[model samples]
Target chain A: MNSGRRQFIGRGGAMLAGLAIAPGMLLYDLAHGRPASGAVRWGMLIDTSRCESGCDDCVKACNKENGLSGGTGPADVQWIRKLELKDSRTGRGVSLPMMCQHCEEPPCVDVCPTAASFKRADGIVLVDRHLCIGCRYCMMACPYKARSFVHEPVHDQKPDVPRGKGTVESCTLCVQRVDRGETTACAEACAKAGHKAILFGNLNDPGSEISRRIKAVASTQIRADLGLNPGLHYEGL
Target chain B: MDLLQARRDTRIFYLLVGLGALVVAAGLVAAHYMEEYGHIVTGMNNQIVWGMPHVFAIFMIVAASGVLNVASIGSVFGKPPYKTRAPLSGLLSIALLAGGLSVLMLDLGRPERIIVAATHFNPTSVFAWNVFLYSGLFAFVGIYLWTMMEKRMNPWSRPAGLLVFVWRIILTTGTGMIFALLVARQAYGTAILPPMFIVMSFAWGLAVFYIVQAAMYGWNEMELNPAILKRLKNLLGLFILSVIYLVAVYHVTNFARHAAFERFILAEGGIYPMLFWGGYVFLGSVLPLFLIYFPRLGGKHHVLVASMLVISGSFCLLYVLIIGGQAFPLSIFPGYEARSSFGDGQIGSYAPSLPEILLGCGGLGVSFLITTIGVRALNFMPRDENTQAGD
Candidate 1:
């Protein structure tokens, strides 16, 4: 073969190897994801007026996404719950979804002996599976009762959401999807259900849709008396 | 007196040790099963994360601190009678702590991963501080015990005892703060809890000491000195009254800000009310006082009965405080009536399963086993001075 022809074949072989390794590198990037940026403080604003009391699309979406049993039993782990409330004096009825508030100073993080319950710089609260001793001190400390211990063995977990028995778990704000630059399963599902009540975005960006809407309305954090400064808010509640 | 009597004593000792060993083995097996099946086999859930095991473990832990007060009276306060009982007091403290800690460590969802607690510490966590406090208690108390037991170390016992005395208060404070530091819970979160726990420890620990001391004396067919008996019972009576006083203060203070919680704990909560009023107040406190202080009724057996009631009362009070505290619904929305699928605003329920009970019993068994072995091997018995209280 001519020298020029041989060089061209070698180049072609190198191109083939590159094609094979490209997908692997992309997967590696996905596997060991870049740390969530400090610039973005993610938050949610719920318009209770638009939220239907009977609708449970948000809950179902979360269960499906997180691979939870979604059972209503006392032992079953659930990330979100819908609360029905009636004012004692005025007889006014109200309804809203409840989950981890992802506080600025989370009590769970404060009480966890092993620092397993932690808050990311971006304000996402999470349990480090490797370190959690399952003492459930966080469960006791939480005013909202948002965290749940895995009471039974877990099976058929989503590959992205690795769950185990004998560990405390709660909403991660759909971290897997969030890391992939997608909105939470619950918020997406609620939007799909035509409620348009659940809005998720970066509160730091004043130009973002959630920020503009929050600015336009009076939104209140649940248990504002606690001064948890939650990432989630409610409007017209 | 005879070979047969000594042989009989050995047989009885073995029997007691065997019983304790059996219980410990069973408890360990139950814990193993819980680890295998997950907490699904246990009655504890997300709402009531702690159950019978915590009750037993906490009781032992709190009482362990209180038991050391006997030694403190001798070594720290320079009391003659309390000084005589100091060695046995030290032994009980160590034994009880061992049992309590064992149950606490084993009950974790990931009991095998408990080393993570030591490796990754959160400074803000009361539980983490407790870890250090508990180990410190063992170290300091061990040193204190050594000083008391060793001839050359006798002079050091006073300082060691002083250090242990101070460390134990901090340790008990850490235990009480486990609940007191919680910002949201109504049953806990009171500044008064640490003091309440301290007094409670005194009563509970003394009651335990009485029972054990009585047992040891009975085994040797010896009579407790009348003056020592009188002083101990009177001290117990005072501790009981202190406990009642603290309980009243706790309720009254809570009533002002948290009327609903007060209502739930005091009256509206069925078991809670019953446990507090009937179980703790009447049976554990009042009846015991009557038995201890009643004119012409201050027999040894009567005092023993009073101590028994006090011990049971401690359990009743703690049950109301710990389990009942969790049972009451959280006032997430103060003015609004709330309902939810996740038991929001509804009372959290718990019924301890067999494994949970066994795990707790196993912790007690561990204490018993250690005490039995320690008492048998060591010169822990108290010899009557044949003089009065001040002697």
Candidate 2:
């Protein structure tokens, strides 16, 4: 019995040692080869008071730009949305545009098993469609419920945008538009109205409108207590 | 081959597999149609973003993890009744894991790429560690069970089983930490989640075992020992008490401060209150306790019924936790209502679409089908070897 137990212990130790080695090896390579770096920090400032509840122009613009229908369905994706709200006590109604807040310390990035959900050097929280396993832990970990899983098979999937079933997706902060040195679709739409409810700039840059407004007003980060330090700021209480 | 036993087992296995396959196919077809039509097929939307599938998946995973408790008692502690029941306990652990993983795969958008999760390594991610832990734990249990099958148990079996036990606890912690560590979310943050998971695990694990044992025994197989049943019931009873205590403390402390979290979960108008009362407290925790502890009851079938109730309640617990956490909006905009941002002065609504349900259900079918087939092929349940000779 003693020998049997000893042998079991030894074998178990060996198995665990093997598991430990695999992760250790990966960490070594990551540390040596491709250390995380700084890139562009895509930040947004949304003045909720400026948003119109009746017109989903931002949602429409995003859908059109991303080849989506402004339809309400699981597969009918929403990159940007206008959500209605009412006063908690008095019951007065208003609308707020809901999208990915793109946190500097993103929970999705912290929970992804495949490193598919990552924060770009420039501070944009994005998902690598190719690498994403669609485990939805990132979705679960995301405090805002900002992430959505593509539950159905995709039809007419654009070549440029590789959306698929069994994968999670959310606001990419318009990576495609950013790649082209352009403003986000929603930001562009908000810009057209000259209300500037949506402001885009480098969060790191002090002179940027986002940074300036963040400094100028008593701006708040939604779920600020979460400690996610979201790059997106909402101004005007 | 005792043609009778072989034939009976084969027939049962085939029937289960066939039925599972048919349901899976039907679900897939429905899912395909729903996806094509859009997410309107099921009862979920932004308000109630989580529904039956989410509930089912969490239950399965919790149930899967719970199976380990029995295995640990028998294999690790070497206690009476539990020691004799090691082989059966081990087999049940694998079976429950199958059920859990199945739900996960179907719940996913890209279940096919699950393999990639194993291949890619993300150091900073808790979910990444979870995938690794889950794989290792499963492999260890599988091998340990295989080792125990031979008339001469392999020297490796005990240690492998022990490792699985330790790893499973860690895995359960990781699962809980997925919520508790979310400092960003108001609903979950207490240090109690890990211990809560542990308590929940034992309750869920014992409940599943009770039901499985009853089914395996048929109407009157009588293979299960009365002593074992008594011990298991006692342990389960203890777990129920712990679960109640922990839940009370978690809520009471949060409520004392009148925190938004407390208001969200306990207040009359909030979704948190509705789900906590409707799902977790009454269904999962309270009723099961009554069934387990009440007088002149807690017999085999009663225990089985109680276990089923616990399982159902546990599923609801996960549902309430996952969905309820997301119901509150992150932004605290000025001149806006505090709660209305979640939806139109209501909680965010969600229902699992057909594809989501199909995939979730398919995961269950797959888990059952796999366990049924694996047990038949791989000698999962331990044989007496020499029943006439006492240990």
Candidate 3:
């Protein structure tokens, strides 16, 4: 009876000690800022109805952020662009911003020879500049027409975006800012321009603004029949 | 019968080699310029990424695999008539592949990062698989040639030849999958492409072989046996017919599933339709068929003319398939007309510049130079006891 009581006390003390260390471990993790996990899936919800025609602020902002300027030729790079769509049947016109769809099963990733095209755990698709061999096979595989091959040598590149010639690039959803716990440049620009058309947030979090909007509204993917499960969803396509 | 080395100390041979080397040098210069400046110098833009260089590179690579079929027929099938020609077939496969691979490598935007491609591999990519298949082809063909030439190694010739034949099929299939596996393109995403490429390799490869054989005969001041010539011409005709049949089936299938793509390629596809009908069908296929069949109209030069037509037609087919496929606007927004900063919903245009043309021709020059050197070093000429008896 005495030994059993001592064993119970010992177990209770060990449990108390574990409880004491748990809060400190969590505080350390919070202080260090743990890397983004797969549990948080980033996504975008675009309300085309709210999008205004001839408003290229989002495109311009993306360019400024990514340092894509001075060349607008057919061969020049365009990470994001404003697309005007006119319905053939209804003759109704609408404008929207187009960029990489960031599919869960990205075809670009599948066709890349050097595994340069990849998707991060947080659902952001990116091209690894170091690994890219500039074969353009990924360009051919991309259905969204989001990718662009750097045909000429770039000058005055932003320090954050290290773009160079002979490599394929695409919209990274402002991954640098996202990593720093901020939204994409396009989304911020859209909101700043008094047009809250683009909403960027964590899709996995039910409480996130984008996720709530998607659940409340009917959102459509560009080519939904392809079953790519794109992270970018659109209302009023 | 004894094998004899070609005469190396000839003025004509030296002139031919010099001309080939000059062309290859020009190609290298063009590649250097493109690399130094950027792809902006080329006609290829955002829409049309691949251009003339791909057409030439793909053709040579496909033909390289096809040419090896001759040796396979000899060693694998034990065909007596084809046995003597196996050595030349093996040599041509290596030479043509080297030429094709050189063009493909030079056309890369980051050719310097070739080591990255070699070291880092993505198993899903057909291009990555092709790197392995292409290098393996060279090694296998080399071993196959060695087995055929070396007396002691002759015992293993059949097995080596069989392995090469199987490898070549996979190589051509991978090449076809490069375009076909893309679900994004309306012109691609079909199972027919691999088989079509296989048949194309057969036709194009045979055409290359016939031309080389004819040239070797001319160089030796000899004539091919009438029986052998007849058999080869008939085989070429059959291969051409097979290609025609495959093309018809592909169009019919596309018409049912992708009518828009079919209309773009077949009916209203400006240069594409013309190239397909006039170049590939009429001049490449139908005309060759007539020459091979009629014989009287083509006279003694029927084989040469037919082979030339086939080669020309192949170039046309590849151009239409590669360039035309890219020219058609991508269907990003179905049922809606799209306008953007990029050329969305607009037909893209690509005109091959002088540099691209020079680079393309350099591949041919490389093959020619290699062929000349190979024949000069070793006896790749076809020999027939029956022909000597007739002489």
Query: Which runs in model 1 stand beyond 4 Å of their true positions?
Result: A1-32, B386-388
Q: How should the candidates be ordered by lDDT, best one leading? A: 1, 3, 2
DockQ of predicted candidate 3: 0.62
Which residue pairs in model 3 clash with each other?
Answer: none
If both were scored by DockQ, which would come out higher, candidate 1 or candidate 3?
A: 1
The residue-by-residue lDDT of candidate 3 on A1-237, one tens digit each, is 999999999999997787787854565567877666899898899999999999999998998888998356789999888899999899999899999999999999999999999999989999999999888988898898899999999888888889999899999999889988889999999999999999999999999998898999998998888889899999998
**What is candidate 2's TM-score against the reference?**
0.79
Q: How far in Å is the alpha carbon of A19 misplaced in model 2?
A: 31
Report the lDDT tens digits of candidate 2 across residue range B1-391: 5788778877877888799888767656654554454344656554444556666666666667777776677677765355545666666666667666665654445556677777888898876777777777678877777666765766766787688788888888877776677664556666778778877888887887777667666622546555455666777878877887887787787566436656766665355566677766787667766776788776767677777877777766676667765665443443455432224234555644556667567756765666566656654443333332121
Which rank order by DockQ, best down to worst?
1, 3, 2
- Residues A1-237 of candidate 1: C-alpha lDDT, one tens digit per residue: 699998999999897787677854555565787778788999999998888888889999999999998898888898998888888999888888889989887999999999999998788999998899989999999999899999889989999999999999999999999988999999999999999889999999999999999999999988889898899999976
- TM-score of model 1 vs. true structure: 0.94
Candidate rank order under TM-score: 1, 3, 2
Question: C-alpha displacement of B262 in model 3, angstroms?
Answer: 1.8
lDDT-better candidate, 1 vs 3: 1
